[model samples]
Target chain A: MNVRIDTYQQAVSRILRFDRVQRTAHWANALLFGILMLTALLLYFPGLSGIVGRRALVVNIHVWTGIALPVPLLISLLGPWGARMRRDLRRVNKWTRDEIAWLWALGRRAPRVVDKFNPGQKLNSLFVGGSIVVMLATGIVLKWFQFFPVSWRMGATFVHDVLAFAIFVVVIGHIIFALAHPESMRSMVKGWVTEGWAARHAPAWLREETGEMEEDQSVAHSD
Target chain B: MTTTAKGAPDQKAGVTIAVGRRVFLGMTALGLAGIVFGARLESVLDSGLQRLFPWWPGFRIYSISGSYPMISEAEYRLEISGLVDRPRVFTLADLKAMPSTSFSQEFQCVTGWTVPNVEWEGVKLSDILDEAGVRQGATALSFESYDGADSESLTLYQAQLPDVIVAYRMLGAPVTTEHGGPVRLYVGPMFGYKSLKWLSAIRVVDQVIPGYWEQNGYPLNGWRDGSTGPTDLALTGGVA
Candidate 1:
């Protein structure tokens, strides 16, 4: 009754792959966004504007990175590559009978490991994506308004502050996970994974893409 | 303008070298374009969009029903009345003579943009009120701006959120005419509506009164963090 896109394994492998340009933009944006967030936090502390000295420079950097953040993000939205990445990122849940049994046995932790994205990552994507849009809008409004009334600006401040805080927390989690799972980080850095690493962490994806079952994998290993 | 500069090499030098020259020129042009665009954008960001679009209704403030300029310092007057033992009428000079308090905080607008950490300098409303002395039963104060767009009045509690102050200076400079110079109120923490410009009057009252925007169906309290809708009729109850 239901159609499945290439098995979960294929989707995972696709996501783990990135081109050199994609990786460069991804890391550049990550660094820039991190700096922008830090400057934003500095905005809260008095006298920081003096050291950064020019409010205009702070805003310039913030706006530039804001503009840049969307570039890599949008580029990742095309063709087969984008499609697979989207599938992996999607919150669509497809739990098989065995998976259901595993969930029943392991409680919350089982689904966390098997789920396409843990609830937190899904929430993080939504919040971060939403925050970027809001920040862009408010930043432009503040920057180019012929007559930005006071009330709207005030409201924007609260939203920006709150979202920035939320992003900070979520990004911390993302960093921790990337570091904790060195192999996961390695794939992103290297743009390719060996058969062994692929089989261990993404066996289902490996099997789906190669059309090899677990039994076939042992036969291949012996050969 | 010619593609080559005055001291630059002649195009006749060689085709291969000319191609390299053309590439260099192209890159320089792009770099120059980026710098120009970046600089323009920087200025645009520093001044805020309100400065760019004056005709937009949301960008301007209308007082007490939009009949006339909602705020005009020229027609403004500050009266210390109510339970005050000595009700005094202070001119702009009188208010300016008072000790001033200034600090920087984010200026938030409800429409969704913020001018971070604007330096605001003004005399504390409380300090002025204390000098005049609040008589018994003086539960609140009221503000009236030159803008008559508001159909109702704002109560003291609404006016005197801790972040509130009668501001006169911004960014360490006495406000210019364009920037609500002479004297204006800066309501901290709240959106720009709370900071009335061309502020000319302050009066002590015994009861909470809805402000101009409040009567116009804006939130009475107008707290920035409340529900994300324009529920202006809700009263913020507290004594300031």
Candidate 2:
């Protein structure tokens, strides 16, 4: 068996490619977003809105936060970080033969070391994309009730709030996976992975980009 | 490209895979549709639910800085006094003597629901202030609601929004008792809080003092559209 050490520049560029900072910022926003939605739900109970004092303050904060929620996400998108993240996440998804085999042998084999994103990632991309759209549409409707009829506005509030809880669960899953896999977190945070890690996980990527092969043992030994 | 690959596309596995893809796509489409319905549904539910149950506080068109279970217009009279060279007590009819301005705009409650485009016809608060010839150094206006439901104060500076009118008509009809009828002050451009329904008296104050709601906890000036204030005034003041 042979393996090669991919160059530091090549490995670093590939890992550093996406707007990971924007991803972090987006995740950070989920906390406040959840708080706003939940409080709005609380205000819906009978005898609550006019309970006056803290309840009313909570209600006010909920509305103000709802109005403010989209601002950070919108600003992040206009920045370079947001644009690059959009570009990288849109990478055409292809499964190599080895990955196909991994899929076939799912229960029989240990999880494969992976480069970039795995199958679950593609699904997550879809989930987050769809989630954002739903949250944005429903959220604004709830926030700006005067823009629509009362019947329609009421419905928007219901949907906006229930979906917020759903997003909360999804975000938890995402964080758990990130923690369970330190390598994934490291790549995002540091924007680089050692050559050995790449050779084991993303051999094809390493080969394609560096014109080097794991078959080159001497280079691997040097690293 | 290989014999093994050809063999792998067997009937049972291929059928399952194709069915799985169909199911996945179907689920995605359903999810997308659900989200659309969800977004629209929340608003629809809020209004439909309100229409079904109009008596709910969030849906009630008759609430302002004061108490409820209010007095009738026959018994209701508005007194304009304090620092005005002349003090006068006028029945609801006297208020009708003044020219009125009416228009419809959204009335936003702090609790996240707004009744949109409420058509109101009433005297402009400005008309009354001008008639009273507000004395200089009268920095604030105090409002007294009939039925003694609410007594609230606002700064003259804050009361000057362009759409602030002392509304009398709602939706092309005379305002009903249930809707602050006989004559309610509709501060159109201000938050529903400032629109003090069941209004009965206007007093000019020398200083900007917080009134019933403001003193309790509500913001000093509740101008909807993201007003920064406490939830609402403590509900202890007399009727509106």
Model 1: how far residue B159 lies from native, Å: 21
Deviation (Å) of B153 in candidate 2: 2.2
Worst 10 residues of 2 chain B by lDDT: B10-19
TM-score of each: 0.42, 0.42
Give per-residue CA lDDT, model 1, range B1-240, as digits (tens): 011121122212211122223333454343333322433443355446447643211222222221233334454466667668778887666767898787888665554435556798878877777778877887766676554332234455554455577777788887644345566777675656667655656667777666664543455555556442454443444521
lDDT of each: 0.53, 0.57
| Model 1 docking category | incorrect
Q: Residue A144, candidate 2: how far off, in angstroms?
A: 18
Name the candidate that leads on DockQ. 2
Interface root-mean-square deviation (Å) of every model? 22.7, 10.8
Q: For model 1, how big is the iRMS in angstroms?
A: 22.7
